[model samples]
Target chain A: MKIHQLSVFLENKPGCLSAPCRALAEAGINIHTLSLADTKQFGILRLIVRDWQQAKTVLESHGNVVNVAEVLAIEVEDKPGGMASVLEGIERAGLNIEYMYAFTIRRGDRAILVFRFEDAEKAAQALSKAGINVIDSVALYDLVEKG
Target chain B: MKTEHCDVPFNNVSAPDFLAVAKLRELQLQRLQCIVDRAYNHVMHYRDAMEQLEVRPEDIRSLDDVRRLPFTDKTALRDNYPFGLFASPMNEVVRVHASSGTTGKPIVVAYTQADVDVWSSVMMRSFAACGVHAGDIVQNAYGYGLFTGGLGAHYGAEALGATVIPISGGNTERQIMVLRDFGVTVICCTPSYFLHIAEKAAEMGMPLQDLPLRAGVFGAEPWTENMRRRIQELTGVRAFDIYGLSEIVGPGVGIECDQQNGLHIFEDHFLMEIVNPDTGDPLPDGEEGELVLTTLSKMAMPMLRYRTHDITAIKTDPCPCGRTVRRIDRISRRSDDMLIIRGVNVFPSQIETALLAVEGTLPHYQIIVDRQQGLDGIEVQVEVTAELFSDTVKELEALKSRISHAIDSTIGLRVAVSLVQPRTITRSEGKAKRVIDRRTN
Candidate 1:
């Protein structure tokens, strides 16, 4: 139902984004999908990974703090109506979005919107009924490159 | 000139009982003027602060005129960097000491040759107040580098003409051997390190009480009367609290006399104020607030109304010793270090005191302040010795619970307790970083 997300809290500085990636490579955890929430002091580098438990262990072992939570990824069209419809379905479901960020899934025609919902289970059920191809764990694991 | 009393460390300025109380306001204004002059002329950060206060350096005359000057804080020191509040040229500085560079930035403070002498005199008085005299052989186990406590005590003992040993910190075995062989009379170090030495002495079958050491001076950290009682019982020495900072001339600005009444500030050399940290307005005596200082006799780096976030009170009750200098109660805690847990002030020092009382838990600790479910929670991870953890898991948890409960009772803040294996948190070579402030930088 959920993929492990490696959320790295980095003090907004140069080369801070690379440490988690480097640690992941060393520990051999593949990143499926990721989004970044940037702020003035620090940035949250959130990642959907194949093995969350292992990713958490690796990051903690490297002295990095990581928190695990479930996020929904809705694959939408690259067109203007694509994001608009997906957002409409999410808002229409009566699920509040604490934070939302989008990343390009493929060659720019399709975009993946990652969401943190208060009611993840209810939102997943509501979005799937709206004909939205919600990104499942199986689909996410397969998309991850075996670095 | 009363040159005989001039040599007295922490000399109390005696006035008639009624006069002392009446003159406190007069003294404050006189001191306040010193603060304004130092801020306006030397530190630009303070000068700008004074400008914002709609005050000028020339406007400050006597103590009543101090209202025109602005206050100071640690953040201002950080913003200025390196030499923001220094009152003299770098070449005039005889030495420089700094606080631990935790909490984003470290506070760097300088001392001139005269400031060093003033520090030693105050510290000498610190020792003498605790009955430290010339003939006593003093073993200064306090660390020597940077931070003021160790060397401040060291030079003061030397100035008092005591045979001094510069055995700078750690290697408990050597400290013990030196105590036995040298027959040292006075010991100086942080209160926690004193406990560490006492425990080691007991373990080694060494009778620490059998040593010639009669008294000790401890500071740079806070401790409780319970811990002090235990330390005194262990070492058979009367423990005294000596207070100062690198900004104000190191470890000997004020010290508790044999009476253990309060820290007698060298008010002539340094001015004292208890200010409302929020409003910057001065608070009257017995009013607990941030302690502010102004150095009247320093040249290297004169500080004016330097706000030392140490939370305590300035009490002028004439000591039985007959000194009129206002005595400061032992610092209960620091304002900046206060952990606002659910609108309650929870300080790590309070937690440290609790952990030290539990016997097995060492003084070294890291307090993790995290946000859970939109409410701030605390996780105190204390490292115990291998002996304490090997046999008893349940018992250790009980100790943790007991500590948490004690801290809850003391500070009105509840915290979750976690026990870790021996040597879990890295020991800092210099100032121990006992706190990991996850709440804010």
Candidate 2:
């Protein structure tokens, strides 16, 4: 129902985004997907890895402050209204989404969406009751490997 | 007949700046006794504090006995508010000046007619010490309102028999124009403001060095010796430091003699002492500590052992200027400006010094103090330099850790360091705001 995502604090500057990427690349950890949220002063780089625990330890060793967050990877149709249908259920279930991003690759006609809800447990229950398929960490890792 | 104490006799009748040391101490003791008696008899706050300490006016028999009295701090003034601390009635107070009170209500200080006369005389002496003699056209650039800097310098310059230009602060273009057109020989203002004026003068295509300005009396903010040298080099003027606060008697309490090594505190009017800031125990001469002052002759509102919060040390060696009055090291930091994080006293200047010592760092930084879970923490946000910034978090984090380590060694406490983009920190025209304390008391 949930997957581990690595959030690293970074100053918003010319070369900040390349830092953790180089760190992960040096550690031989492949980043599955990543997104950046920024203000004027700093940025938060949120990325998914096949082995987040190892990635976290490696990043920590390299002096990066890594925050691990549990996010749900939902499988949705890649067609129009696919995201809208999923968000409708989320709005109907009254679960608040703090932030959300998408995976570049698609599995068949479905796309994977990563969501950080304010309450992950309650969000899982709502999405489960809505009959939506939520991908777990093991299955997501397998899907990334197959892709 | 020439006096043994003064090589060049002062025309001012009240110039006791060159009095013999023995006679000076005797006068101080007498004035101290009188001021303490007046404060005890009139001001309820002083009387209450002295009573709590079991000290009476008579207990201050000698000059050394001032230590027995309680130390009055800024809070004492705030607690009293406007006129609560005034020893004289409203009729005798000819004028009143106040601090900017950036934190709270302005600290009000009153001066009687005699007090004003004394202020004028000391200011005149201050001008003389800085080589602003009569017939010198003085440009008083200190802000002239209730701030005490403007009017204080004004009265003193006039009393020195110099031509006074009542131009207050700001109006940089006009200030430079007057500096050129008026044949102004002396300029008085804050050191930072003078830097701005010099910059403006250069922009106007009239360099201050080319002007007739021969002397500058800069004060109202703590400035460094390096800044003084830069000002002298840029302006071609003998920059003198004038030190005082509104709580004492504006900018005439002390002035740098031609020696320029330290500022001489007029002991006949303001008795000076150096004491440990935390312990309140008096430190020996030549040791850096908090400067505590006692007004020996102020009648309107006599301050007894008032803590100035300015950090300086008394010079053990006599000044070559032949003034018997003692000199204090130039004040660059005030105890009031100190930030205590995790029980360690840290000054912004110390942080600045630490930041500049590192190999790849700019002087631009801000100290942010906050509290969480009942514990104090400090975060130093340093502007990222092109050399310090990198494409990898590893090197950037290394830079952060290096900065943190530098500050830790300088202030003796661990601090969290954050790197922000360049030019994000705000800069002010006047005194630069260096610290942002978010900790709620």
Candidate 3:
């Protein structure tokens, strides 16, 4: 399963982050999680939101260059060696992870980690073979609503 | 050989090579006759010079006959003053631009609507040669005013349909800010000034190589290959050398194409020549000498055989860009003592005029020009009178400021003015030594 994420281009200046945040708020679009990548001149704001199509439209209408990328949301044990175990499997499978981030909320004894891989399709197959519980967009949204 | 008659005169020429060269010569001849006729009829200076030499417009039948025409120099323009050299009436002249001459009086140039259009067309071609296209954001950093660099690049970028930011020089921080915010893909300015900006950008923790700027059009001063390599390594921009002078038109005369070997001259509008500086004899192709230019289509003021005094050679080899126009080597030397300080032409006589205008300063002065930390710095050392030298420090400071202000107002460049005792500056018997340039490149 894959999740859609919106990456926006913005200048690294004051109020640049709030502009899109305010736009999403006015449009009633909920952002599940967001991470900011920055350089000296500008920054890229990556957002995982519900109703990504509507959110992208809202952000673009406010003059932002937005790109949609597919990322995977997988559940991991909330133990010390959970991430290491997933990394060992990924290394054996020869799947390259570009970046990853964690969600604030979690299920009973598990945590959700969003990962961006070089090839999402192949990574999805490898994770499925490894018996990892991957959450689809609908299930992810349902989990967010419950929390 | 043509078997049948055609409406177009040269349509029957068969060989492509012959046709191309012949057609270019035909256009040059036609335009040359027109310009000479216009200059000879309207301008009194050209008329008197041509009459004294016993040469008429009809004498210029072949391109080689250009040698028969009188050579026009900067002094001729100064002699004509504000509007004497202009062939068109003042009402029809759309614009006037003045640049620093050898003396206090600046050389004035005029342009009609058609002349301005020609300038824009050539500049658009220049940008295209440098791989700049429409929709590219061009940041023009040349000084805007009577100087032609700023407005020339501005109008050309706008005419090319690119978005132009008219940020005319200075304010290095603001330049970097606008460059990053507007996603400027191209920048037009002098090479030294661009280096200064790059230095400031680095100091501000914003390196230029990280920005989206892709190309730079640098001109108005001579730069070397080493500096080009340094700029490219530092900022990752494809630096292109553009050559021009206000006496001709502006910075649209010629530019280095993607080949980056030599600058291709727009032969359709301006004719090029290289002549021996001392003898004024026309040199063959590939010989280094003085640069002479003749405007083919300028209506307001048509310059016939104007000596540019810039030393460069003509490239006889064909360019990969496929344009039939010829190319010229980059200019690295001049035949005179005119110093380009921060892209403004500075002559010793202009400095002398500025220093003499101040009350307590003597005519004995020396200009020292150097390139320190990638920027051109000029310091004027002048001798003060015995009374002014013995005066209080406050009055001496005031005199220094007045002399500096006079120079700034005359040449549009800020320079350091230092006052010295009289007779300290060595006096030469024949000619006084005025300029001492320490720049290696």
Which candidate has the top score in DockQ?
2
Overall lDDT per candidate, in order of appearance:
0.70, 0.82, 0.84
Tens digits of per-residue lDDT, candidate 2, A99-131, equal 888999888999999998866778998899998
lDDT by residue (B202-289, candidate 3, tens digit) is: 9999888888888899999999999999899988888999988999999989999778999988887888899999999999999999
- Superposed by TM-score, candidate 1 places the C-alpha of residue B401 at a distance from the truth, in angstroms, of 29
TM-score of chain A of each: 0.82, 0.97, 0.95
Docking class of 2: incorrect
Which residue pairs does candidate 2 place in steric collision? A19-B392
Interface residue Cα RMSD of candidate 2 after superposition: 9.4
TM-score of each: 0.57, 0.64, 0.70
> In model 3, which runs have C-alpha deviations exceeding 4 angstroms?
A1-147, B1-19, B359-361, B421-432
- As a whole number from 0 to 100, the lDDT of residue A29 in candidate 3 is 90
Ranked by lDDT from best down, the candidates are: 3, 2, 1
lDDT of 3 by residue, A1-147 (tens): 899888776556788789889999999998889888665534567889988999989987886657777899989889999888988877887887777888877988899999888777889999889877788888998998899
Per-residue accuracy of model 1 over B1-441 as CA lDDT, tens digit each:
101112334423222212364475566556556646765788777777878988887787766455456656656666767876787788888788876322324568888787788777777767777777777788998777765767888888898888899998768889988987888778887776777777777888877777767778887666557767878777787889888777678877788877887888877677788888888788999899989887766766667678788889988577887666779899877777755453233556667766766664455578887654223578887654423332112344566678788766655557877654334477788556777755331
Task: Please list all clashing residue pairs in model 1, or write none if there are none.
Answer: B9-B125, B12-B324, B13-B324, B13-B325, B29-B63, B30-B63
The 10-residue segment with the lowest total lDDT in model 2 chain B: B1-10
